[model samples]
Target: MDVGLLFDLRNPAQWHRPWADHYARTLELCEEADQRGAGGLWFTEHHLFEDGYLPQPLTFAAAVAARTRRARIGTSVVLPALHNPVDLAEQAALVDLVSGGRLELGLGAGYRLPEYQLFGADFQRRFAGTERNIREILRLWEEKAVTPLPIQDPPPVWGGFYGPRGARIAGRLGIGLLHISHAMFGHYREGLAEGGHDPRSARVSDLLPIILAEDPEAAWHRVAPHLAHQVNSYRQGSVEGTGRSTPLLTAEDLRDPNAQDTRGLLDILTPEDAAVRIRELTKDLPVRHLIFWASIAGMPDDLVTENIRLVTEKLPPLLR
Candidate 1:
Protein backbone atom coordinates (compact mmCIF):
# COMPACT_ATOMS: atom_id res chain seq x y z
CA MET A 1 0.00 0.00 0.00
CA ASP A 2 1.15 3.53 -0.80
CA VAL A 3 1.03 5.55 2.46
CA GLY A 4 0.29 9.29 2.38
CA LEU A 5 -0.44 12.12 4.85
CA LEU A 6 -3.66 14.22 4.92
CA PHE A 7 -3.68 17.81 6.21
CA ASP A 8 -6.93 19.65 7.00
CA LEU A 9 -5.10 22.83 8.05
CA ARG A 10 -7.66 23.66 10.73
CA ASN A 11 -6.87 26.51 13.13
CA PRO A 12 -8.96 25.38 16.10
CA ALA A 13 -9.67 28.23 18.54
CA GLN A 14 -8.46 26.24 21.53
CA TRP A 15 -5.01 25.42 20.11
CA HIS A 16 -3.59 28.82 21.20
CA ARG A 17 -1.09 29.23 18.40
CA PRO A 18 -0.67 32.10 15.93
CA TRP A 19 -3.11 31.58 13.06
CA ALA A 20 -0.44 31.74 10.35
CA ASP A 21 1.79 29.23 12.10
CA HIS A 22 -0.24 26.25 10.88
CA TYR A 23 0.38 26.96 7.18
CA ALA A 24 4.10 27.53 7.67
CA ARG A 25 4.37 24.43 9.80
CA THR A 26 2.45 22.39 7.19
CA LEU A 27 4.94 23.42 4.46
CA GLU A 28 7.89 22.39 6.63
CA LEU A 29 6.19 19.09 7.50
CA CYS A 30 5.34 18.32 3.84
CA GLU A 31 8.96 18.89 2.77
CA GLU A 32 10.18 16.60 5.54
CA ALA A 33 7.59 13.90 4.71
CA ASP A 34 8.70 14.00 1.08
CA GLN A 35 12.36 13.65 2.04
CA ARG A 36 11.38 10.81 4.40
CA GLY A 37 9.66 8.97 1.47
CA ALA A 38 5.97 9.69 1.96
CA GLY A 39 4.06 8.79 -1.24
CA GLY A 40 1.66 11.75 -1.14
CA LEU A 41 0.47 14.88 0.72
CA TRP A 42 -3.31 15.31 0.63
CA PHE A 43 -5.18 18.47 1.70
CA THR A 44 -8.83 18.78 2.79
CA GLU A 45 -11.45 21.39 1.79
CA HIS A 46 -14.04 23.19 3.91
CA HIS A 47 -15.53 26.68 3.86
CA LEU A 48 -16.82 29.27 6.36
CA PHE A 49 -15.77 27.39 9.51
CA GLU A 50 -15.12 29.42 12.67
CA ASP A 51 -11.42 28.60 12.96
CA GLY A 52 -10.72 28.94 9.20
CA TYR A 53 -10.73 25.46 7.71
CA LEU A 54 -8.83 25.31 4.41
CA PRO A 55 -11.17 26.36 1.59
CA GLN A 56 -8.63 26.53 -1.25
CA PRO A 57 -6.84 23.20 -1.13
CA LEU A 58 -5.60 23.41 -4.73
CA THR A 59 -3.90 26.71 -3.94
CA PHE A 60 -2.17 25.20 -0.94
CA ALA A 61 -1.40 22.13 -3.03
CA ALA A 62 0.42 24.37 -5.50
CA ALA A 63 2.70 25.51 -2.68
CA VAL A 64 3.27 21.92 -1.63
CA ALA A 65 4.21 21.04 -5.22
CA ALA A 66 6.93 23.70 -5.23
CA ARG A 67 8.42 22.54 -1.92
CA THR A 68 8.23 18.75 -2.30
CA ARG A 69 9.78 16.98 -5.30
CA ARG A 70 8.61 13.45 -4.49
CA ALA A 71 5.30 13.43 -2.61
CA ARG A 72 2.21 13.49 -4.86
CA ILE A 73 0.35 16.74 -4.00
CA GLY A 74 -3.44 16.46 -4.03
CA THR A 75 -6.76 17.59 -2.63
CA SER A 76 -8.46 14.91 -0.56
CA VAL A 77 -11.80 16.11 -1.97
CA VAL A 78 -12.29 19.32 -3.90
CA LEU A 79 -15.92 20.48 -3.95
CA PRO A 80 -16.89 20.89 -7.58
CA ALA A 81 -20.34 21.96 -6.46
CA LEU A 82 -18.78 25.34 -5.67
CA HIS A 83 -16.44 25.72 -8.63
CA ASN A 84 -16.34 26.30 -12.37
CA PRO A 85 -14.93 23.06 -13.75
CA VAL A 86 -12.92 24.85 -16.43
CA ASP A 87 -11.17 27.08 -13.89
CA LEU A 88 -10.52 24.16 -11.59
CA ALA A 89 -9.03 22.22 -14.50
CA GLU A 90 -6.72 25.10 -15.34
CA GLN A 91 -5.52 25.36 -11.76
CA ALA A 92 -5.02 21.61 -11.43
CA ALA A 93 -3.04 21.48 -14.67
CA LEU A 94 -0.78 24.27 -13.41
CA VAL A 95 -0.17 22.40 -10.16
CA ASP A 96 0.49 19.21 -12.10
CA LEU A 97 3.10 20.96 -14.20
CA VAL A 98 4.75 22.42 -11.09
CA SER A 99 4.76 19.09 -9.29
CA GLY A 100 6.23 17.32 -12.34
CA GLY A 101 2.94 15.49 -13.00
CA ARG A 102 2.51 14.22 -9.44
CA LEU A 103 -1.12 15.23 -8.89
CA GLU A 104 -4.07 13.08 -7.80
CA LEU A 105 -7.28 15.09 -7.95
CA GLY A 106 -10.11 13.85 -5.73
CA LEU A 107 -13.45 15.46 -6.61
CA GLY A 108 -16.59 15.22 -4.50
CA ALA A 109 -20.11 16.48 -3.91
CA GLY A 110 -19.56 17.65 -0.32
CA TYR A 111 -22.14 16.74 2.35
CA ARG A 112 -22.35 20.06 4.20
CA LEU A 113 -25.25 22.30 3.11
CA PRO A 114 -23.91 25.57 4.47
CA GLU A 115 -20.84 25.32 2.28
CA TYR A 116 -23.08 24.91 -0.77
CA GLN A 117 -25.18 27.84 0.40
CA LEU A 118 -22.12 30.04 0.88
CA PHE A 119 -20.77 29.14 -2.54
CA GLY A 120 -24.15 29.47 -4.32
CA ALA A 121 -24.18 25.80 -5.27
CA ASP A 122 -27.46 23.89 -5.42
CA PHE A 123 -27.40 21.13 -2.85
CA GLN A 124 -30.17 19.19 -4.56
CA ARG A 125 -28.19 18.92 -7.79
CA ARG A 126 -24.75 18.32 -6.25
CA PHE A 127 -24.26 14.78 -7.58
CA ALA A 128 -25.26 15.76 -11.10
CA GLY A 129 -23.16 18.88 -10.90
CA THR A 130 -20.12 16.87 -9.76
CA GLU A 131 -20.54 14.51 -12.70
CA ARG A 132 -20.81 17.41 -15.13
CA ASN A 133 -17.72 19.00 -13.59
CA ILE A 134 -15.70 15.83 -14.01
CA ARG A 135 -16.79 15.46 -17.62
CA GLU A 136 -15.75 19.01 -18.40
CA ILE A 137 -12.39 18.60 -16.63
CA LEU A 138 -11.54 15.45 -18.58
CA ARG A 139 -12.62 17.01 -21.84
CA LEU A 140 -10.47 20.08 -21.20
CA TRP A 141 -7.40 17.99 -20.50
CA GLU A 142 -7.61 16.30 -23.87
CA GLU A 143 -8.49 19.34 -26.05
CA LYS A 144 -5.43 20.95 -27.59
CA ALA A 145 -6.54 24.55 -26.97
CA VAL A 146 -5.87 24.09 -23.27
CA THR A 147 -2.50 25.71 -22.53
CA PRO A 148 0.20 24.68 -20.06
CA LEU A 149 -0.71 21.07 -20.70
CA PRO A 150 -0.38 18.80 -17.70
CA ILE A 151 2.79 16.67 -17.68
CA GLN A 152 0.53 13.77 -16.75
CA ASP A 153 -1.59 12.85 -19.78
CA PRO A 154 -5.09 12.98 -18.38
CA PRO A 155 -3.74 13.42 -14.84
CA PRO A 156 -5.06 10.90 -12.32
CA VAL A 157 -8.50 11.97 -11.08
CA TRP A 158 -10.27 10.21 -8.21
CA GLY A 159 -13.92 10.70 -7.39
CA GLY A 160 -14.79 10.73 -3.68
CA PHE A 161 -17.67 8.37 -2.91
CA TYR A 162 -19.96 8.37 0.13
CA GLY A 163 -22.16 5.56 -1.17
CA PRO A 164 -22.72 3.17 -4.05
CA ARG A 165 -24.19 5.84 -6.32
CA GLY A 166 -21.05 7.93 -6.07
CA ALA A 167 -18.94 4.87 -6.75
CA ARG A 168 -21.01 4.08 -9.83
CA ILE A 169 -20.38 7.56 -11.15
CA ALA A 170 -16.62 7.17 -10.59
CA GLY A 171 -16.50 3.87 -12.42
CA ARG A 172 -18.68 5.06 -15.30
CA LEU A 173 -16.37 8.04 -15.69
CA GLY A 174 -13.31 5.77 -15.64
CA ILE A 175 -11.74 7.65 -12.71
CA GLY A 176 -10.40 6.40 -9.41
CA LEU A 177 -12.54 5.79 -6.30
CA LEU A 178 -11.86 7.44 -2.95
CA HIS A 179 -13.67 5.87 -0.02
CA ILE A 180 -13.53 6.68 3.68
CA SER A 181 -14.26 3.24 5.13
CA HIS A 182 -13.15 -0.29 4.36
CA ALA A 183 -16.78 -1.45 4.49
CA MET A 184 -17.51 0.50 1.28
CA PHE A 185 -14.82 -1.23 -0.78
CA GLY A 186 -17.24 -3.90 -2.03
CA HIS A 187 -19.74 -1.26 -3.13
CA TYR A 188 -17.02 0.53 -5.10
CA ARG A 189 -15.86 -2.64 -6.82
CA GLU A 190 -19.43 -3.57 -7.72
CA GLY A 191 -19.90 -0.13 -9.18
CA LEU A 192 -16.79 -0.59 -11.30
CA ALA A 193 -18.17 -3.82 -12.75
CA GLU A 194 -21.59 -2.24 -13.20
CA GLY A 195 -19.99 0.46 -15.33
CA GLY A 196 -18.67 -2.23 -17.68
CA HIS A 197 -15.13 -1.69 -16.43
CA ASP A 198 -12.79 -4.24 -14.98
CA PRO A 199 -12.87 -3.83 -11.20
CA ARG A 200 -9.22 -4.80 -10.84
CA SER A 201 -7.91 -1.95 -13.04
CA ALA A 202 -9.77 0.86 -11.27
CA ARG A 203 -7.72 2.58 -8.56
CA VAL A 204 -9.09 2.58 -4.99
CA SER A 205 -8.00 4.61 -1.96
CA ASP A 206 -9.19 5.50 1.57
CA LEU A 207 -8.79 8.15 4.26
CA LEU A 208 -8.02 6.70 7.68
CA PRO A 209 -7.65 8.65 10.93
CA ILE A 210 -4.80 7.29 13.06
CA ILE A 211 -2.57 8.23 15.97
CA LEU A 212 0.65 6.47 17.03
CA ALA A 213 2.62 6.61 20.26
CA GLU A 214 4.86 4.53 22.57
CA ASP A 215 1.94 4.14 25.01
CA PRO A 216 -1.51 3.60 23.46
CA GLU A 217 -3.28 5.03 26.51
CA ALA A 218 -1.36 8.28 26.43
CA ALA A 219 -1.94 8.62 22.69
CA TRP A 220 -5.66 7.98 23.11
CA HIS A 221 -5.93 10.71 25.75
CA ARG A 222 -3.92 13.12 23.64
CA VAL A 223 -5.96 12.56 20.47
CA ALA A 224 -9.40 12.12 22.08
CA PRO A 225 -10.21 15.85 22.33
CA HIS A 226 -9.11 16.55 18.80
CA LEU A 227 -10.94 13.51 17.48
CA ALA A 228 -14.08 14.55 19.32
CA HIS A 229 -13.86 18.07 17.99
CA GLN A 230 -13.34 16.76 14.47
CA VAL A 231 -16.38 14.47 14.71
CA ASN A 232 -18.52 17.06 16.48
CA SER A 233 -17.70 19.72 13.96
CA TYR A 234 -19.34 17.60 11.26
CA ARG A 235 -22.29 16.75 13.54
CA GLN A 236 -22.85 20.36 14.53
CA GLY A 237 -22.60 21.52 10.95
CA SER A 238 -25.22 18.97 9.81
CA VAL A 239 -27.94 20.08 12.22
CA GLU A 240 -30.10 21.74 9.52
CA GLY A 241 -29.17 19.17 6.92
CA THR A 242 -29.06 15.37 6.57
CA GLY A 243 -26.99 13.96 9.44
CA ARG A 244 -25.12 10.66 9.34
CA SER A 245 -25.11 7.93 12.00
CA THR A 246 -24.08 8.82 15.54
CA PRO A 247 -20.89 7.43 17.02
CA LEU A 248 -20.61 5.86 20.49
CA LEU A 249 -18.98 9.02 21.78
CA THR A 250 -20.92 12.21 20.99
CA ALA A 251 -19.27 15.60 21.17
CA GLU A 252 -20.37 15.88 24.79
CA ASP A 253 -19.10 12.41 25.68
CA LEU A 254 -15.65 13.22 24.38
CA ARG A 255 -15.65 16.63 26.09
CA ASP A 256 -15.87 14.89 29.45
CA PRO A 257 -12.35 13.69 30.27
CA ASN A 258 -13.70 10.72 32.22
CA ALA A 259 -15.57 9.16 29.30
CA GLN A 260 -14.53 5.50 29.02
CA ASP A 261 -16.14 4.15 25.84
CA THR A 262 -14.16 6.11 23.25
CA ARG A 263 -12.45 2.88 22.19
CA GLY A 264 -13.63 2.40 18.58
CA LEU A 265 -13.87 6.09 17.67
CA LEU A 266 -10.27 6.17 16.38
CA ASP A 267 -7.24 3.95 16.03
CA ILE A 268 -4.94 4.71 18.97
CA LEU A 269 -1.95 2.39 18.68
CA THR A 270 1.77 1.95 19.21
CA PRO A 271 3.83 1.95 15.97
CA GLU A 272 4.01 -1.85 15.91
CA ASP A 273 0.28 -2.26 16.51
CA ALA A 274 -0.60 0.35 13.90
CA ALA A 275 1.52 -1.49 11.34
CA VAL A 276 -0.35 -4.73 12.06
CA ARG A 277 -3.77 -3.10 11.54
CA ILE A 278 -2.61 -1.55 8.25
CA ARG A 279 -1.25 -4.89 7.07
CA GLU A 280 -4.57 -6.61 7.76
CA LEU A 281 -6.34 -4.06 5.49
CA THR A 282 -4.55 -5.28 2.34
CA LYS A 283 -6.13 -8.73 2.67
CA ASP A 284 -9.73 -7.47 2.38
CA LEU A 285 -9.72 -4.17 0.54
CA PRO A 286 -8.53 -3.33 -2.98
CA VAL A 287 -6.71 -0.26 -1.69
CA ARG A 288 -4.00 1.19 -3.95
CA HIS A 289 -3.25 3.92 -1.41
CA LEU A 290 -3.86 4.63 2.30
CA ILE A 291 -3.85 8.26 3.36
CA PHE A 292 -3.55 8.97 7.12
CA TRP A 293 -4.80 12.18 8.73
CA ALA A 294 -2.26 12.85 11.49
CA SER A 295 -2.99 16.54 12.05
CA ILE A 296 -6.47 16.40 13.50
CA ALA A 297 -8.43 19.19 15.24
CA GLY A 298 -5.44 21.46 15.65
CA MET A 299 -3.08 18.85 17.07
CA PRO A 300 0.17 20.39 18.26
CA ASP A 301 2.88 20.71 15.61
CA ASP A 302 5.34 18.55 17.53
CA LEU A 303 2.87 15.70 18.02
CA VAL A 304 1.68 15.84 14.40
CA THR A 305 5.27 15.78 13.18
CA GLU A 306 6.11 12.74 15.29
CA ASN A 307 3.00 10.85 14.20
CA ILE A 308 3.91 11.52 10.56
CA ARG A 309 7.46 10.37 11.18
CA LEU A 310 6.38 7.14 12.87
CA VAL A 311 3.92 6.19 10.14
CA THR A 312 6.19 7.20 7.27
CA GLU A 313 9.13 5.23 8.64
CA LYS A 314 7.45 2.20 10.18
CA LEU A 315 4.35 1.37 8.12
CA PRO A 316 5.93 0.88 4.66
CA PRO A 317 8.46 -1.73 5.78
CA LEU A 318 5.76 -3.90 7.32
CA LEU A 319 3.61 -3.63 4.18
CA ARG A 320 6.52 -4.72 1.99
Candidate 2:
Protein backbone atom coordinates (compact mmCIF):
# COMPACT_ATOMS: atom_id res chain seq x y z
CA MET A 1 0.00 0.00 0.00
CA ASP A 2 2.48 2.61 -1.10
CA VAL A 3 0.28 5.71 -1.16
CA GLY A 4 0.61 8.68 -3.51
CA LEU A 5 -1.22 11.80 -4.67
CA LEU A 6 -2.39 12.07 -8.30
CA PHE A 7 -2.34 15.55 -9.88
CA ASP A 8 -4.63 16.26 -12.84
CA LEU A 9 -4.19 20.05 -12.64
CA ARG A 10 -7.63 20.81 -14.03
CA ASN A 11 -8.94 24.38 -14.20
CA PRO A 12 -12.66 24.03 -14.65
CA ALA A 13 -14.61 27.08 -15.89
CA GLN A 14 -17.08 27.16 -13.02
CA TRP A 15 -14.31 27.78 -10.52
CA HIS A 16 -11.56 28.88 -12.81
CA ARG A 17 -8.42 30.48 -11.47
CA PRO A 18 -6.00 32.32 -13.72
CA TRP A 19 -3.74 29.81 -15.52
CA ALA A 20 -0.71 31.10 -13.65
CA ASP A 21 -2.41 30.87 -10.29
CA HIS A 22 -3.69 27.39 -11.03
CA TYR A 23 -0.20 26.22 -11.89
CA ALA A 24 1.34 27.89 -8.84
CA ARG A 25 -1.22 26.30 -6.52
CA THR A 26 -0.60 22.94 -8.20
CA LEU A 27 3.11 23.26 -7.42
CA GLU A 28 2.29 24.15 -3.85
CA LEU A 29 0.24 20.97 -3.51
CA CYS A 30 3.06 18.85 -4.94
CA GLU A 31 5.59 20.34 -2.49
CA GLU A 32 3.16 19.78 0.35
CA ALA A 33 2.55 16.18 -0.66
CA ASP A 34 6.29 15.56 -0.89
CA GLN A 35 6.95 17.12 2.50
CA ARG A 36 4.16 15.13 4.12
CA GLY A 37 5.69 11.76 3.21
CA ALA A 38 3.77 10.83 0.09
CA GLY A 39 5.48 7.90 -1.62
CA GLY A 40 4.98 9.29 -5.13
CA LEU A 41 3.24 12.04 -7.13
CA TRP A 42 1.48 10.87 -10.30
CA PHE A 43 0.04 13.02 -13.12
CA THR A 44 -2.66 12.52 -15.76
CA GLU A 45 -2.67 13.69 -19.39
CA HIS A 46 -5.45 15.09 -21.56
CA HIS A 47 -5.52 17.52 -24.46
CA LEU A 48 -7.81 20.34 -25.65
CA PHE A 49 -10.33 20.24 -22.86
CA GLU A 50 -12.55 23.13 -21.80
CA ASP A 51 -11.41 22.56 -18.23
CA GLY A 52 -7.78 22.82 -19.32
CA TYR A 53 -6.98 19.26 -18.33
CA LEU A 54 -3.23 18.87 -18.24
CA PRO A 55 -1.84 18.34 -21.74
CA GLN A 56 1.88 18.23 -21.09
CA PRO A 57 2.38 16.05 -18.04
CA LEU A 58 6.11 15.41 -18.44
CA THR A 59 6.81 19.15 -18.62
CA PHE A 60 4.88 19.79 -15.43
CA ALA A 61 6.52 16.70 -13.94
CA ALA A 62 9.89 18.30 -14.57
CA ALA A 63 8.79 21.39 -12.68
CA VAL A 64 7.49 19.21 -9.85
CA ALA A 65 10.81 17.37 -9.72
CA ALA A 66 12.63 20.69 -9.34
CA ARG A 67 10.34 21.66 -6.44
CA THR A 68 10.13 18.39 -4.47
CA ARG A 69 12.96 16.24 -3.21
CA ARG A 70 11.53 13.02 -1.89
CA ALA A 71 8.47 11.70 -3.73
CA ARG A 72 8.82 9.77 -6.99
CA ILE A 73 7.25 11.66 -9.93
CA GLY A 74 5.42 9.86 -12.75
CA THR A 75 2.87 10.07 -15.53
CA SER A 76 -0.09 7.85 -14.88
CA VAL A 77 -0.22 7.22 -18.61
CA VAL A 78 1.39 9.29 -21.33
CA LEU A 79 -0.15 8.86 -24.78
CA PRO A 80 2.43 7.47 -27.20
CA ALA A 81 0.64 8.02 -30.50
CA LEU A 82 0.59 11.79 -30.02
CA HIS A 83 4.37 12.27 -30.26
CA ASN A 84 7.39 10.72 -31.90
CA PRO A 85 8.78 8.09 -29.55
CA VAL A 86 12.37 9.28 -29.99
CA ASP A 87 11.52 12.80 -28.87
CA LEU A 88 9.40 11.50 -26.01
CA ALA A 89 12.32 9.43 -24.86
CA GLU A 90 14.55 12.50 -24.71
CA GLN A 91 11.94 14.55 -22.82
CA ALA A 92 11.35 11.72 -20.37
CA ALA A 93 15.09 11.28 -19.85
CA LEU A 94 15.45 14.97 -19.03
CA VAL A 95 12.64 14.81 -16.51
CA ASP A 96 14.20 11.76 -14.89
CA LEU A 97 17.48 13.62 -14.63
CA VAL A 98 15.75 16.61 -13.07
CA SER A 99 14.05 14.34 -10.57
CA GLY A 100 17.31 12.59 -9.65
CA GLY A 101 16.08 9.39 -11.35
CA ARG A 102 12.80 9.44 -9.46
CA LEU A 103 10.59 9.08 -12.56
CA GLU A 104 8.24 6.19 -13.37
CA LEU A 105 6.95 5.98 -16.94
CA GLY A 106 3.44 4.70 -17.67
CA LEU A 107 2.77 4.58 -21.40
CA GLY A 108 -0.61 3.90 -22.94
CA ALA A 109 -2.62 3.81 -26.17
CA GLY A 110 -5.07 6.67 -25.60
CA TYR A 111 -8.80 6.42 -26.41
CA ARG A 112 -9.98 9.90 -27.31
CA LEU A 113 -11.31 10.48 -30.83
CA PRO A 114 -10.89 14.26 -30.93
CA GLU A 115 -7.29 13.97 -29.84
CA TYR A 116 -6.59 11.44 -32.55
CA GLN A 117 -8.32 13.60 -35.15
CA LEU A 118 -6.34 16.65 -34.09
CA PHE A 119 -3.04 14.77 -34.38
CA GLY A 120 -4.03 13.01 -37.65
CA ALA A 121 -3.41 9.63 -36.01
CA ASP A 122 -5.53 6.58 -36.63
CA PHE A 123 -7.55 5.76 -33.57
CA GLN A 124 -7.84 2.12 -34.54
CA ARG A 125 -4.09 1.65 -34.75
CA ARG A 126 -3.15 3.42 -31.53
CA PHE A 127 -2.55 0.22 -29.60
CA ALA A 128 -0.07 -1.04 -32.13
CA GLY A 129 1.49 2.39 -32.38
CA THR A 130 1.86 2.59 -28.61
CA GLU A 131 3.63 -0.78 -28.51
CA ARG A 132 5.99 0.28 -31.25
CA ASN A 133 6.64 3.58 -29.47
CA ILE A 134 7.57 1.82 -26.23
CA ARG A 135 10.01 -0.48 -28.02
CA GLU A 136 11.58 2.39 -29.94
CA ILE A 137 11.95 4.47 -26.78
CA LEU A 138 13.68 1.64 -24.98
CA ARG A 139 15.88 0.94 -27.95
CA LEU A 140 16.97 4.57 -28.04
CA TRP A 141 17.86 4.39 -24.38
CA GLU A 142 20.13 1.38 -25.00
CA GLU A 143 22.05 2.79 -27.96
CA LYS A 144 25.60 3.82 -27.06
CA ALA A 145 25.28 7.14 -28.87
CA VAL A 146 22.27 8.33 -26.85
CA THR A 147 23.50 11.14 -24.59
CA PRO A 148 22.32 12.52 -21.23
CA LEU A 149 20.75 9.21 -20.35
CA PRO A 150 18.30 8.99 -17.46
CA ILE A 151 19.64 9.01 -13.89
CA GLN A 152 18.04 5.70 -13.07
CA ASP A 153 19.51 2.68 -14.87
CA PRO A 154 16.16 3.16 -16.61
CA PRO A 155 13.17 4.43 -14.71
CA PRO A 156 10.72 1.55 -14.16
CA VAL A 157 8.31 1.17 -17.09
CA TRP A 158 4.59 0.63 -16.65
CA GLY A 159 1.84 0.14 -19.24
CA GLY A 160 -1.73 1.38 -19.00
CA PHE A 161 -4.41 -0.86 -20.46
CA TYR A 162 -8.13 -1.45 -20.44
CA GLY A 163 -7.89 -5.01 -21.73
CA PRO A 164 -5.88 -8.21 -22.23
CA ARG A 165 -3.92 -7.36 -25.38
CA GLY A 166 -2.40 -4.33 -23.72
CA ALA A 167 -1.65 -6.52 -20.70
CA ARG A 168 0.08 -9.11 -22.85
CA ILE A 169 2.15 -6.49 -24.63
CA ALA A 170 3.28 -4.95 -21.32
CA GLY A 171 4.09 -8.33 -19.80
CA ARG A 172 6.06 -9.38 -22.84
CA LEU A 173 8.06 -6.19 -22.63
CA GLY A 174 8.75 -6.80 -18.91
CA ILE A 175 6.83 -3.63 -18.00
CA GLY A 176 4.57 -3.24 -15.01
CA LEU A 177 0.78 -2.88 -15.40
CA LEU A 178 -1.27 0.17 -14.41
CA HIS A 179 -4.76 -1.18 -13.89
CA ILE A 180 -7.84 0.65 -12.65
CA SER A 181 -10.19 -2.24 -11.90
CA HIS A 182 -9.71 -5.28 -9.69
CA ALA A 183 -11.17 -7.45 -12.46
CA MET A 184 -8.09 -6.83 -14.60
CA PHE A 185 -5.51 -7.99 -12.05
CA GLY A 186 -5.79 -11.68 -12.90
CA HIS A 187 -5.75 -10.97 -16.62
CA TYR A 188 -2.66 -8.80 -16.23
CA ARG A 189 -0.74 -11.33 -14.13
CA GLU A 190 -1.76 -14.17 -16.41
CA GLY A 191 -0.53 -12.19 -19.38
CA LEU A 192 2.80 -11.75 -17.61
CA ALA A 193 3.01 -15.46 -16.94
CA GLU A 194 2.19 -16.23 -20.55
CA GLY A 195 4.91 -13.85 -21.63
CA GLY A 196 7.45 -15.95 -19.68
CA HIS A 197 7.64 -13.51 -16.80
CA ASP A 198 7.08 -14.34 -13.16
CA PRO A 199 3.76 -12.95 -11.97
CA ARG A 200 5.12 -12.24 -8.50
CA SER A 201 7.79 -9.96 -9.88
CA ALA A 202 5.50 -7.89 -12.08
CA ARG A 203 4.22 -4.75 -10.39
CA VAL A 204 0.57 -3.63 -10.53
CA SER A 205 -0.58 -0.17 -9.46
CA ASP A 206 -4.22 0.96 -9.32
CA LEU A 207 -5.32 4.56 -10.00
CA LEU A 208 -8.46 6.10 -8.55
CA PRO A 209 -10.07 9.30 -7.18
CA ILE A 210 -10.02 9.87 -3.41
CA ILE A 211 -11.38 12.40 -0.91
CA LEU A 212 -11.41 12.31 2.87
CA ALA A 213 -13.46 13.79 5.74
CA GLU A 214 -14.34 12.53 9.20
CA ASP A 215 -17.97 12.35 8.18
CA PRO A 216 -18.10 10.28 5.00
CA GLU A 217 -21.40 11.78 3.91
CA ALA A 218 -20.15 15.28 4.35
CA ALA A 219 -17.08 14.47 2.33
CA TRP A 220 -19.23 13.10 -0.46
CA HIS A 221 -21.28 16.25 -0.54
CA ARG A 222 -18.22 18.44 -0.72
CA VAL A 223 -16.60 16.39 -3.46
CA ALA A 224 -19.60 15.44 -5.60
CA PRO A 225 -19.70 18.34 -8.04
CA HIS A 226 -15.99 18.33 -8.71
CA LEU A 227 -15.98 14.58 -8.98
CA ALA A 228 -18.82 14.76 -11.48
CA HIS A 229 -16.88 17.22 -13.57
CA GLN A 230 -13.91 14.92 -13.56
CA VAL A 231 -15.91 11.92 -14.72
CA ASN A 232 -18.32 13.62 -17.13
CA SER A 233 -15.55 15.40 -18.95
CA TYR A 234 -13.80 12.10 -19.60
CA ARG A 235 -17.07 10.54 -20.59
CA GLN A 236 -17.58 13.14 -23.30
CA GLY A 237 -14.07 12.61 -24.61
CA SER A 238 -14.96 8.93 -25.02
CA VAL A 239 -12.49 6.25 -24.00
CA GLU A 240 -10.73 4.28 -26.76
CA GLY A 241 -11.13 0.75 -25.58
CA THR A 242 -13.88 -0.80 -23.45
CA GLY A 243 -15.64 2.58 -23.52
CA ARG A 244 -14.55 5.50 -21.31
CA SER A 245 -17.40 6.05 -18.90
CA THR A 246 -18.01 3.69 -16.00
CA PRO A 247 -21.16 1.74 -16.85
CA LEU A 248 -22.30 2.21 -13.27
CA LEU A 249 -22.06 5.97 -13.40
CA THR A 250 -24.55 8.18 -15.22
CA ALA A 251 -24.81 11.96 -15.60
CA GLU A 252 -27.45 11.96 -12.87
CA ASP A 253 -25.16 9.87 -10.71
CA LEU A 254 -22.38 12.40 -11.02
CA ARG A 255 -24.65 15.16 -9.70
CA ASP A 256 -26.10 13.07 -6.88
CA PRO A 257 -23.45 11.69 -4.58
CA ASN A 258 -25.68 8.91 -3.27
CA ALA A 259 -26.48 7.76 -6.79
CA GLN A 260 -22.85 7.00 -7.54
CA ASP A 261 -21.51 3.64 -6.40
CA THR A 262 -18.51 4.88 -4.46
CA ARG A 263 -16.96 1.44 -4.20
CA GLY A 264 -14.96 1.02 -7.42
CA LEU A 265 -14.32 4.34 -9.18
CA LEU A 266 -14.29 6.81 -6.29
CA ASP A 267 -12.55 6.36 -2.91
CA ILE A 268 -14.33 9.03 -0.85
CA LEU A 269 -13.78 7.76 2.67
CA THR A 270 -13.03 8.50 6.26
CA PRO A 271 -9.76 7.09 7.60
CA GLU A 272 -11.61 4.20 9.17
CA ASP A 273 -13.44 3.59 5.90
CA ALA A 274 -10.18 3.58 3.95
CA ALA A 275 -8.68 1.06 6.37
CA VAL A 276 -11.40 -1.43 5.54
CA ARG A 277 -11.26 -0.81 1.82
CA ILE A 278 -7.48 -1.00 1.62
CA ARG A 279 -7.46 -4.23 3.58
CA GLU A 280 -9.99 -5.83 1.27
CA LEU A 281 -8.27 -4.59 -1.89
CA THR A 282 -4.78 -5.73 -0.84
CA LYS A 283 -5.84 -9.04 0.67
CA ASP A 284 -5.60 -10.89 -2.62
CA LEU A 285 -3.75 -8.75 -5.13
CA PRO A 286 -0.15 -7.63 -5.53
CA VAL A 287 -1.36 -4.02 -5.33
CA ARG A 288 1.92 -2.15 -4.81
CA HIS A 289 0.75 1.42 -5.27
CA LEU A 290 -2.52 3.20 -4.47
CA ILE A 291 -2.38 6.51 -6.38
CA PHE A 292 -5.26 8.99 -6.08
CA TRP A 293 -6.40 12.41 -7.27
CA ALA A 294 -5.87 15.13 -4.68
CA SER A 295 -6.12 18.45 -6.57
CA ILE A 296 -8.98 18.18 -9.00
CA ALA A 297 -11.77 20.04 -10.85
CA GLY A 298 -12.38 23.07 -8.68
CA MET A 299 -11.87 21.28 -5.38
CA PRO A 300 -11.16 23.95 -2.78
CA ASP A 301 -7.54 24.15 -1.67
CA ASP A 302 -8.51 24.01 1.98
CA LEU A 303 -10.50 20.79 1.52
CA VAL A 304 -7.71 19.26 -0.52
CA THR A 305 -5.18 20.10 2.18
CA GLU A 306 -7.38 18.63 4.85
CA ASN A 307 -7.79 15.37 2.91
CA ILE A 308 -4.02 15.11 2.49
CA ARG A 309 -3.49 15.77 6.20
CA LEU A 310 -6.04 13.20 7.30
CA VAL A 311 -4.78 10.51 4.97
CA THR A 312 -1.18 11.17 5.92
CA GLU A 313 -2.06 10.97 9.56
CA LYS A 314 -4.09 7.78 9.36
CA LEU A 315 -3.95 5.62 6.18
CA PRO A 316 -0.34 4.34 5.88
CA PRO A 317 -0.11 2.50 9.21
CA LEU A 318 -3.09 0.31 8.32
CA LEU A 319 -1.29 -0.99 5.26
CA ARG A 320 1.60 -2.07 7.44
Summarize candidate 1's per-residue lDDT along 1-320 as a digit string, tens digits.
58899888887888856866878988898999999999889987888777688889999999999999988887889988789987898999999999999999999988888889888889989999999999889998888447878899988899998787898888778888887456666677777787787887767787875676667676666776777777777666765355545553454575455656443456757778877887776566667778888687887666787788877887778677
Cα lDDT of model 1 overall?
0.81
| Predictions in order: lDDT | 0.81, 0.80
For all predictions, the C-alpha RMSD in Å is 3.2, 3.1
Candidate 2 structure quality by residue, lDDT tens digits, 114-232: 88777888888998889888988888887833668998877888899979788878877778888745667667777778778888777788675566667767767667777778777
Flag clash pairs in model 2: 111-240
Provide the lowest-lDDT 10-residue window in model 2.
240-249
